[model samples]
Target chain A: MSKNEETEKSDVKDSTAAFEEALAKTKDKKYVLHLYVAGMGPKSIQAIDNIKRIFDEYLPGKYQLEVIDIYQNPVFAREGQIVAAPTLIKELPPPLRKLIGSMSDTERVLLGMDLISKPNENDEKQQE
Target chain B: MIEEKDRTLKEKSLEKAPTGINGLDDITYGGLPKGRTTLVYGSAGSGKTLMAMEFLVKGAQKYGEPGVFMAFEETAEDLAENFASLGFDLDGMESRDRLLVDHVHIDKSEIEETGEYDLEGLFIRLGLAIDSIGAKRVALDTLEVLFSGFQNEAILRSELRRLFRWLKDRGVTAIVTGERGEASLTRYGLEEYVADCVILLDNRMEEQISTRRLRIIKYRGSKHGTNEYPFLIEEDGISVLPITSLSLEHEVSTERISTGISRLDTMLGGQGYYRGTTVLVSGTAGTGKTSFAAQFCKAACERGERCLYFAFEESPDQITRNMKSIGIKLQPYLDSGLMQIHASRPMAYGLEMHLMGMRKILDTFNPDVIVIDPITNLISAGTEIDVKLMLTRLIDYLKLKNITAICTSLVQRESTEGINAQEISSLMDTWINLRFFESNNERNRGISVVKARGMAHSNQIREYMLTNHGIEIRDVYLGPSGGLLMGSSRDIQEAKETAEIAAQSKNAARRKRELESKLKSLDAQITALNSEFEVQKEELDKLSSEEALRSNALAKDRSEMARIRRADLH
Candidate 1:
C-alpha cells in the first residue's frame, strides 16, 4: 500500500475508535444507589462503611454511589423510601436492586449488584 | 421534562397508610387513601389534638407505619408528656425511629413570604422527617396556630390549599387539625373544602351534665355514622359509644331475683323480677320509696351480686344510717366491695354532667344491679323533657349492657291518683305504689303491686310496717267492724277493745245458764202434785158410784113397786 493511503486508513481507524469510545461512555451503565440510615448513629456509620467497601471491590471502575443519611438529609432518605438502617440501592443497573443490612456478605452483595454469577458446585469441584 | 415523568411515576408508586380508629376508618372507609389529607375541625378542648396524636401514635405502633407529628400549639416535650398520661410512649417511639415529633415554632412576625415561593421549604422539612424513618402517616396538629400568624385570609387560604396539595402529592396520609371558626370550620374555610374528610368533636353540657360527642361532617367517597356518638376521655384515650339502632332482637334474661320482701316477691308472680329489667317505684313522700329501693339493693348484695346505689336525695352515710333502721345494713356490703354508694345532689352539676359522671362511675364499677333513689331529684337540674330524655338514654344504655336497674320517683300526694310520671311508666318493667291511708282515725302505709311485666302480681293492697327489726307486710284483716284502722298501733288498739267487750258478754251468758237450770227443777215439782190430785178425783168418783148403787137399789125397790103399779095402770 502507499504510505499516504496507509496514513489515511490509520486515521480513519483512530476516528472510529474515538467514536466508539464516545458511544461506550454515553451508554456506560450508571450506578444508581440508595443509602438508608436511621438518623445519625454509629450503626449508620457501619452501614455506610460496608457499602463503600463493597462498591470499591466489585464496582471500582464504573459506579456512582449516593450517600443518604436519614438525619442530616432526611428528604432524600424519604424520597428513596428507606425504612430500615443501612439499606443500599443500585440504580445504575437496568433493573434496580437493593441490599439491606450491613453489606457483610460479599457473595450476596455481588449477586445483588449483578456483578458475578452464582457459583456452581461443579466449578468448585473441578478447581479442587 | 424529567421532573414531569418523575412526578407521574411517583403518583403511580404511592401506597396508602391505614389509621386504626373505628368510626373514623368507617367514614374514610379504608383510611385516607394512603397519602391524602384529612381535616379535623373542632372548638377548644374538643379532642382535636388528642385525636391527631392518637392517629399518629396508632399508625406507628399498630400498622408498622412510621409517623411524623408536627405540633404548633404544644412543644415536642409537652406533647409527649400529654400523650404519656394517656399511655402513649411518644418518646420511646421517637427513639425507635418509628415516630418523629417536630414542634414548629412559627412566629408569624418572622416569616415573610411575599411572592410565589414554593412551600418546598416546609415540604422539605416534612419530607426530611418522613424520609428519615420512611413514615407513612403525618399529623399537623392545629393549622389554626400557623394561620393566626398571617393577617390576610387569601394568603392563608392559598397557602393551606398548597400545603394540602403538597401532602397529597407526596402520597402520605396526613391529618390536619384546625381550631373551629365562629361561622365556618376554619377561619380560612379552605381546609374543609380541600380535605378529603372532616370530623367535628363537641364538648357540651346539658343541665350541667357534660358529654363529649363526635360527629363526621363530611366524607367524600365513603359512608359514615352521621349521628353524634357520646365519647369519653380518660387515662386510656377517647372512646365513643355509638348508639346502635334500637331493634327488638336484644337478648332477654328470664332469671328472677328477689325483691328482698317475701310478700312483695309473692306479689311479683312468686319470683322477684326478671333479669335486666328496670323497676320504677313511685309514690308520695314518706311512703317507703327509698326503703323499697334499699331493700332491692340489700337483696342484690345478699345474692353475691354487686349493686350500685346512686342517691340524688340522700348522702351515702345518711342512706346507710336510714337503711340500718329498716334492718338493712349496707355499710358492710360497701366494705366488702359488693356494694357501692354514689350520692350526689341534683343541682350539684348540670344534668348531662351528672349523666357523664354516672356513666364514668358505672364503667369503672360495672355492677350487676343499679339503684337510683328518687330519680325525680334529677329533674331539679333539667326540664321535665330533659329528664325524660336523659332517663331514656340511660335506660337504653343500661339495657344494652344487660344490667338490672331500679329507679325510684317521688310523686305528689295528689298526683298518685293518676299516672305519677307518665313519661317513664311505659319504659319501666315494673311499677310499685306506696301510699298513706287513714282508717279508724289512724294513719297507715299500704303497698300495692300496680303492674309487673311478664309476671302475675297480686292485685290486693297489703299493709306494711316499718319497725326497728325490718319491714313487715301483714295479711288482709277481714273484720265485721264498720271502720278499719290503718296503722299497726291503731289496729292493735282496736283488737284489744273488741276483745274486752266480748269477754264481758261471755261472763253474763254463763250466769244466765245457771238460773235457767234452777227454774226447770221447780216446774217438775208442780207437775207431780197435779198428777196426785187427778188420781184422788178418780177414786172419789168410784166411791160415789157405789153409794149411788145402794141408793139406786133402794130407789129401784121403791121404783119397782111404783113401776108395777104404773105398768098395771099402762
Candidate 2:
C-alpha cells in the first residue's frame, strides 16, 4: 500500500509540471496582428483576403485572423490601421504587430509579425 | 408601505441645476432646484425669449447638459436665424445632439377645449425630443401663446399645473416663458402661483429710450438676488448683470484724472476730479455741456488712458466732426484705438436695456473715463423717478469700480430756475452750471462752478468762447458792469471817464474857495480905509483947533487937506 501511494504522488507531480509549462507559454507568447488594405473601396476586399491567405500560409495552424472592411468602417481607415484588402492576425503569438499596403512585401510582413530575424546583407539584396 | 420609523429614517436629498452665467450663480446661491419649473414673465420685447434661450444654450455648452427648446410663438428655424446675429450657434449644438429644438404651432382660431383633456400631446413631444438627445434642460418659449388658442382658462390653468408637476416628475429643469399681465406679474396669475421660481422682465421707454429690467420675484428653497438686474441682447448673446451688493468695503483710489481744461482743473483743487468721481455738467441748452464732456474724453485719450464716449443724441460721425471743428482732434485717438465712440438714440431701446448695454461696453472696454453726453436724453425713456434711480445705480456702479464718470444734463432755462428741476444735480461730486446771458445786445456763454466737493473753486463766472481752436475761457471779465459783453476794453473806458469827471469837480471847488477869500479880503480893506479916513479927520480937526488961529484956514481944510487929500477925495 505504501508503494502504491508513492507512485500516485509521482504521477501527480508530472501532471503539475505539465500544467505549469502550459501556463508559462501562455504568459510569454502574446498574440500579434496586422490588417492591410489598398483604399476604403472594395478593391481592398482581397487585401483582407490576402491576409487570410498569409494566415493560411504560416500561422493558419494556431492563429486567429479578422477581416475588416475600411469602407464600411471609415473611422479605422485613415490611420493605416488597414492598408491592403487582406490582413492576418497571429493572435497566438506574443506582442501584437501590423503590416500595411499590399501583402507583396512578405518578408517585411514576416519581419513585422516577428516570424523572422533581422535580415542579413544577402536577404536585403534579395529583397531589393 | 413604510411605517413611521422607516419614514423617519429616510434621507431627504435635493438636487440643483446650475445656470452658467457669471455672477448670477452666486446670486442664486447654488442654482434653481432640479426638475422644478420656473416662470419667466415679461412685457413685450423684454428679452424673455432671449433670456430663456441663453439659459438653455449656456447649460448645454458650458455645463455639458443637453437642452430641449419648445417654441410656441416662433418656428425653430426662425428662432435660430434670429439669434444667429447674437453668435448663438444653435445649429452646431443641434448637430452634435447636445440640443433639441421643437416648434409648436398653435392656431388661435381653431382651438377648442371641453371637459378635461390631458396635455399629454405636448408631454409626448417633449418626451420624445428629450429622450432622443437625453436633454437635461427644457424651455417652453411662451406658454401664453398656447392660451391664446384656447379660451378656457380653467382648463389651461389645470393643464399648466399638470405641466409643471409633470416636468418635476421628469426630473429635468424647465423654464416656462409667459407674458406679463396688464396689472399682474403674469397674464395668468395661476402660473406665477404654481411656479417654484418666478422672474419678471419689464421693457419700458421713458423719453423715447427703451430699457429692459429683470427681477426675480420668488425663488423657493434658494437665496436669490432681490434687486432688478439689467440685461442686454447683443452680438455675443444675452448677458444679465446682477446688481452688485452694496458694500462699504470697496477701496477708493486717490488718483485723479484731468478735466481737459487747465483752469477747470485748477478750480477742482489744483489737480482734477478724483478717480471714480461722478462729475455732473448741468445747464440750459447751448451751454456746451456735451463739448465739455468730450474735452475730458479727448484729454484722457491723449494721455494714453482709454476713453468711451456714449452720445445719446448725436451720431458718432456727427460728434467726431463737431469735435474736429472744435479742434479736439479725436481722429488720431480713434485711429490709435484709444478712444471709442458709441452713439445711439435714447429712444432706440428701453432705459434698462441702454443701461445694460452701457454696462457691457464698460466691462469689455474697461475704459478709464466714461462720458455720457447729455444723460438727460435718457429721461425721454423713463419717468423722472426711474431716471433718478437708474442714474443713482449707475453712479454707484461707477464708484464701486473707481472709474471716473462724466454725465451731462440738458436743463431748460425755466427748469433750471424752477424749484423742481428735472436734472440730476444732487448726485454729483462736482456740479458745473452753464448758462447763456444777453448783454450788450449780444448772446454770451457763461460757466460757473456751482460746487466742488473737497475743494475750493473760483466763485467767479467765466465767459467761454467757442472758437475754431477749441473753447477759450477768457479771464473772469471783472468789469464794473455786470454784463458779460463788457469786456476789458469797456472797463478801461469806464475808468478813464470817472477820472475826467473827478478833475472837473476839483477845479470847480478851487474856484469857489478863491472867490470866498477874495470877498473877505475886500471887506477888510474897506474897513481899514474907513478907519484911516476917520483918524485922518480927527487929526485934521485937532490941527485945525490948534491952528484955529491959523486957520480956519485950512479952510478947512476944506480941504483939510482937502482933506487932504481929498479926504480926499473925495
Candidate 3:
C-alpha cells in the first residue's frame, strides 16, 4: 500500500510539473491589460470584474491585469490617453486595441481584440 | 435644486468678491458673489477671454487674492502675450506664486473616449494649483473646447456640477467663461448650472461701427442694473461704463458758470448756466453751434478747470485751426493737458458706444466741463430714441458727478421757425436755440434761450456776432415803424436816427436867433418912444415955467385961496 501511495503521489507531482511547463510555455502568448477607471462606480466596478472574469476563464494564468483608478493616479490617466473611465487597453500586443464601455458584451470585446471569429455572414461580407 | 441652494447660500452670507473692473463694482453693488461660481458667456471676439484674464490678474494684484487660470483653449504663453499690452504682471505674479495658469492642450481628433468617466483629472489639477498658491479666485477661460473634445456629455454635465460644488466648498470665487449660444446664454446651456450669476457679452456692428455690450442677465438675491452697459477692452484692460445711474438721487448745485461770451452769459439767467447742469445748444447749420461750444470750453479751460472737447465732424487739428480764427487758444490748453480734444467721426461707433467712450474720457480726464461739438451728427448713426436715450444717460451721469456738459444739436433749416427745442426737452436742463434770420436780403444770427430749468433766462432774440475777438450779442435795432432790424438795415436805421437828431438841433438854433432879434427891435422902439415923451415933457415944462413966472404974482393970492381949499380938502 505504501508503494502504491508513493506511485500515486509521484504521478500527481509529474502532472503538476507538466502543467507548470505548459503554463510557462503559454506565458509567451500572455495578454498584458490595463483597466483605467474613475472611482468605483457601478459600471467601472462591473467592467473590472467582467474583464477579469473573461481573462480568467479563457486564458487562465496567462494574463496580467493592472487596474488603475484615474482619480488616484491622474498622471497615468493622462499618459495613457485615457479620456474616459472603465477603458480597457491591450498594452503589450503589437496592434494595441482599446475597448470602451461596460464589458457586458464579451463577444464584442473579443471581436474588437480579434480574439474571435464572426459568424458565416461576416465571412461572406469579407469575401465581397 | 442648485438655484435653491445658491439662493440660500447668498442670503446667509451676503458676501461679495470685488472684480477690479472700471465702473463694474458700482453696477454690481460690490462684485460677484463670494465663494460662488459666475458664468460669463459671449460670442467670438467679444472680449470674454480678456475679461476673464483681467478678473484673475486684478484679483491677484488689487484684491490681495491669488488666482488660478485654467484655460482649455488658449495656451499659457498665448494668454501671456494676449494680455501683455494691458500691462498685467502675469509672469511676475506666476513667479511669485500668486497666479497659477494651466493650459490643457486638447485636440478633438486626438481625444478618444471609451467609457464612463468624470473630469476628475482636471479637478485634481485645478485643486493642486489652488493648494499650491492658496488661491482665492479661479477662472476657466473657456469650457467650449472641453465640450467639443469630450464625447460623453452626460458625464461632462455631471462633472461640471460636481466641479462647481467643489469650488464652492473650496471657498474660492470662480469665473467660468463659455461660448455664446444662438438662443441660450451659453453654447452648452451651462447657464442653468451656474445659477449664482450670469453675464452676457455681445459684439455687434451697426453701420460699420462695432460696439461691445455687457448685460447682467441674472443676479439672484440682488438688485442689478438691467440696461446693457458698454465696455471697452483697451490697453488698461476692460472698462465698463456707468452711463445711467439706476437711481435718480444725485446732488444738485445752485452755483453758476459763465458762457464765455459775457453778453450771452448775461442772457443766461443773468448769471450763467448752473455749474453742474446740462446745456443743449440747438441751431441750424452754420449758426455757430460749434463756435458756441468752443467758447464755453475756452472759458472753462481758462478758469483753470479741465475741459474736454469731443468733435465729431472735424479733426482735432481742424478744430484747433477753426477755433484759432475766433481768438480761442486751444493749443495752449492741449499742451498744458488742461483741455483734451478727442475727435472721432460719429460713425465710428454706436451712440451708446460713443457715450461709453465719453464716459471713459470723463473718468480719465476728470474734466470739469465737456463739449460735444454737434451731437446731431450721432443721429445718422442711430434712431432718435437711441440718441435721446444715450444723451439722457450721458447727461444724467454728468450731473451725478457734478460735471458740466455742453451738447450741440443741429436743426434742419425747414424744420421750424423759433426753435426745435421740443425735440429733446426732457434731456436738456437748459436749451439755447440759435437761428439764422433773413432780414433785408442779409442773413443775421440770433440766439434765444428757450428754457432754463431753475433760473429765468432771456426771452428776447439777441443778434449773435462772431468777430476776431469772440462772440458778441447785440440788442435789436428798432426801426421808425417799431420794426426789429438787423444787419445793413440796422446800420441804415442808426444813420437815419443820427440825421434826425442833427436836423432838430439846427432848427432849435434858428428859432433862438429869431427870438433874440425880435426882442432887440422892441427895445429900440421903446427907447424911441421914451425919447419922444421926454421931448414932449421938456416942452411942457418950458411952457409951464413961463406960465409960472407970469402967475408968480397971482400964485401968492391963489396960494392963500389954495391953502384954504387945501385945508378944507385935507
The number of the candidate with the highest lDDT is 3
lDDT of 1 by residue, B1-570 (tens): 999999998877534455665435544445555678888878899898988888888888789888999877888899888889999999999999989987766554333222222223355568778777898889998888866654556655676788888888987888899888888767676778999877888887664566677787877665666877666675567655444434346688999999888888998999888889899888788888888888888889989999999999888999999989878888999999999999988887766567768887898999999998888788787666656766777788788778898889888763456655737887899988888787566668888877899998888777888877567788666455834345765567668778989998998898888778878877887788788878998899999999999998997788698787876532
lDDT per residue (tens digit) for residues B1-570 in model 3: 999999998779668889999867778888888888888888889988887888888888899999999888888898888778789878888999989888875666443444455565577667777887899999997878766777777877877778779988998998888888878666667655565888888887765666678998888767778888777776688877656654578899988999999988788777889998989898888888888898998999889999999889999999888889988768999999999999898876677667777887898999899998877787776666556666777777888889988989887762345445336666788988888788678998888888889887877878878887778887678767876677888878788888989999999999999999999999999999999999999999999999998899787777788787785532
CAPRI verdict (incorrect, acceptable, medium, high) for model 2? incorrect
Which lDDT tens digits does candidate 2 get at residues B74-154?
Answer: 988998899888778889989999888887766643222212233434665676678889998999989888667655567
lDDT of 3 at B550: 83
Give residue A4's lDDT in candidate 3 (0 to 100).
100
DockQ, per-model, please? 0.02, 0.01, 0.16
Candidate 1 chain A weakest ten by summed lDDT: A76-85
Model 2: CA > 4 A from native? A1-128, B1-31, B42-47, B72-75, B103-128, B144-159, B179-189, B202-213, B223-232, B236-250, B313-327, B414-423, B437-443, B464-570
